[model samples]
Target: MSAVLDIGSHKVVCLIGQQDSNMGVRIIGSGFGVSAGLKGGVVVDMDAAEVGIRTAVEKAERQAGMAIQSVSVNVSTRSLRSQQMEVHTEFASGEVADRDLTRVIESSLSELAQPEDAILHAIPLNFSVDGEDGIRDPRGMFGSKLGVDMHFVLAGIGPLRNLAHCVERCHLRIKSAHVSPYAAGLSVLTDDEKDLGVTVIDLGGGITTSAIFRDNRMVHVDAIPLGGQSITNDVARGLSTPMEAAERIKTIYGSALHGADDDYVNIPCPPMGAQDTLHHHPKSLLTSIVRSRTEEIFELLRDRMTDAGLDVYAGRRIVLTGGGAHLTGVREIAEQVFNKRVRIGRPNGVLGLPETIDGPDFAVATGILKAQFMDIDEAISGPPDLSGRRYRQRRYSGGPVGRSLQWLRDNF
Candidate 1:
């Protein structure tokens, strides 16, 4: 058995796996440990983060009874960006074979601009040749020229470097580090959602990450640097309670949408004095604090969606994942604001995991493990010198050229 470690701000997780024929990759073991030296999904300190990574890895290793060498980590930074690129090549033999297709696809990828940006993943979404469109597999398709549309997920260098250093310092080779949103999307997003359109929102403890998918690949993604912790803070400040108490209160009583009755739940309050005499209605105290902050986060998410031109989801849906996905009334709030169908998503393509980690908090870790089993590490060490090539740029028929209605239609 082999395993990979995911060092996150809230927790450090290890996913242990091995190859299987009938079931694909099977999960034999896993581990979780407290996290230190990580903030907003990036490694804030090397030594402490190394300790957390090693702790999780060793637990999984002990359980699976296998020595580990390398692992694939995840990066969930706010500075990440995504864009789709299309490259075309007239066939040398006026024929498109497997190798020729790969070449042209690589050529298009070579044209993408990632000078200061580190690519987390690049996946081909679709292929169009000549005037033909909607081709999923083009290996055997006959075409005079090959055109490929792909989605590239990129992250910042400092965040990636810090994460890599932490893993390496733990004596484990970093086989790869994928964008957390992409990883989460890979784990929770289904084929139909990806094919039609969907926005995957991962609400972690310290950060809220989002990925917009069209044509079954991630075309746009963004991360909000605030999360459930903010709610906890809001509760603490509003109620004038300790952070721990406020966190407990928020988890027990917080709701994104304001409700009608304040009698939904009763909560204990720390006494103003040393005596344990004071108590309050949990719902009453949460009056505007919890609801306001949560709504603000969703507003930020909507703004991000609008900024990325993903707000037009005529045929798309919103799929929420992560620890915050379980928050009360999130789907309801998102649907009301975005005015679209919304639902929560759980991890897919994994076996033998408890129903708890099966949720959104484990999305990225599960994706990294799945990528490792699929041997997608090569995709992480992407080509650095992508220069001097022609790519398909979006053009709007009636609107401005930068509007890209065709691109929007082709994707959404």
Candidate 2:
């Protein structure tokens, strides 16, 4: 059995799953709770975060009738970003071998200069032989020089350590950490979409993140510390309502696009201090607030892609996921802002998921569970210790090396 924890700004989710004979994950248990002590996907208060994590995990354990010792968690902080690295080496024996592959990747790691940040994922984009590019695997192939293009997802070490410490307080070890956007893409994107190029925008509660996938691998990832929570705050301040009531109103009647009848619809909002007093506001006002904030998010995301020089790579397709994706007219807004085809993406490839939790909001958690069953060859943990002699000796001992090689052959 494997477990995944999706610690978000608005909720904490725990899922326990087991792999079936067909190599698919079946969710046997799942639970979630309102999040506390988190902002923009980073843990701010240890005590409050621990309580939320523990409550979610305990509920899952009760449902699964089993306890867990470790879990793979998702990260979506604003510090999350991606970088590219390339390294090349000559083969002494004129033939590329497993050791040669390892050596090239290790060299790339050594070349990284992010002292304040740690790697969350090291995805091998493609390999090359001699002067030729786009070679997937060079093993057993004759080449005077072998090259590798690597894409690394990185995050601030300080925030990661804080997140890990908060999870540790619940007596659970973090088996691995995955970028929330990448995980969401893994669950929601189709094979053709990935191969043809697509952008996944995770519209989370407190953070909006994007992941660009092409050639069946993530090419870039970025996050901005703004999301659905900002819209809720806008409603609260605009209507003089409490936070709870504002959130309820937003969920029940929020729309990113104005409707012809919105002016006729009236929403009753309880004031902050007195629940007895109600303020009736036209739904048009609420829709205007939501539409303004929603447009800003997509505009910012478009500028981010352009600034990163990845706008061209993003293609004309976009997939929206996470809790904020549930907002009405969000897809249309994204399409208008990005000038791309937009679709609401939901979690797929998992079995036995409850209907209530089987939505785009659960994409990250479901992807985390699916990642354990994937055959891809990439490191999801922190930076590897290539300087260790033990690691060098056992790097290719298990099925991972074979699976990775096969994946490269099949995909690239």
Candidate 3:
């Protein structure tokens, strides 16, 4: 059994499920709550965050008829960066073994041991044997030398510890803190898009993340502390309305691109205060406000990609996921800004999901569940592992927080 908990800036979702006989995840229970105490995906108030988490998980527990002791959560904190590590090593017997691959993978962590950083994921991007390149799995292959490219997802230690503290306060152990954008990519991207090269942009309530996937593995990840909530705020300030009214206006009229009929349409607006009378604005103005903010987001995404030396020059394909992806014209605007093929991505490869909750907004939660099933499949493929404690040591690096993180990983 597995529980996926997604704590975002605007919502907290808990999904409880298990793998069926056919190896597909069956979601038996789900819970959602209005998020509190989070800003830009960072926990700003532990007590408030814990309350929301507890409420969401409790709802899922009631539906599943089971109590969850721990959960796999998504890590969407700001300042999340990726560091690349490439290493070359020669096998003593000229044959690459599982142990040799493990050695090379571990060697890539030397640069990730900074005190202020916590490693969220250490992903092997590519492997090569001898002088040949692009070997997917090199184990059991005879080779004089092996090389590996690894990408490490690292976050500020302060934010991670705060997250851990918030989750702990809920009386639930942390299973694994997965990078939210990576999880979103896993849920929404097709195998072909991954192989041919595609960029996944996750637009959440408080953050927007971009991930580049090539050769079926993630190559880079970047995040901005801006998202759908920013658009809502923009609308509120532009229209001089309350946040609730602004949210309604944005959802009713928001668009990333302006349309021909927008100007002719008129919508009633609430009074700014008791002293002010009601008014009306052209729907075009509302769309324009949304357009400016959303355009800025895509432009920033393009600049970030350019700074990272990544471009759609290769395949020119982009997939948009997360809550903000649902906005009208977002895909079309992204296409114009990046000059690439763009589509909205929703969660797939899972079963028993209700239509109401089955969308890009739930991609991260679904991906967390899929990730757990993948781990189970890997463990079942080989001999049985020893015990949870031993597995933890193999999974997490040894450091001041190693033991604590080992406890966290063991709960998964």
lDDT of 3 by residue, 238-289 (tens): 8888888988888877887778898898877887799998788888899888
CA lDDT of every candidate: 0.73, 0.87, 0.82
Q: Compare the candidates by lDDT and give the number of the best one.
A: 2
Question: Clashing residue pairs, candidate 1?
Answer: 322-360
Error of 1 at 409 (Å): 38
lDDT at residue 132 of model 2 (Cα atoms): 88
RMSD of each: 7.9, 6.1, 6.4
lDDT (Cα, tens digit) per residue for candidate 1, span 1-412: 5576767777899988987777866787788877878888877777777777778888888878887888777778877777778778666434456676666665655566445666667777778877586677777766677787777876776777677767778788766667777788888878788878888888888898888777665677788899888888888777767787887877777777666777576667564446556666557568477668777888998987787667885245988887788788888888887888998887889888777588877888888777766644222262222221212221112465434553344224
* Candidate 1 C-alpha RMSD relative to the actual structure: 7.9
Q: Which stretches of model 3 miss by more than 4 angstroms?
A: 375-412
How many backbone clashes can be found in candidate 1? 1
Runs off by more than 4 Å, candidate 2? 379-412
Worst 10 residues of 3 by lDDT: 377-386
TM-score of candidate 2 relative to the true fold: 0.91
Query: In model 1, what lDDT does residue 96 have?
Result: 56
Best of the two (2, 3) by TM-score? 2
Clashes (candidate 3)? 0
Q: For model 1, where is the 10-residue window of minimal lDDT?
A: 388-397
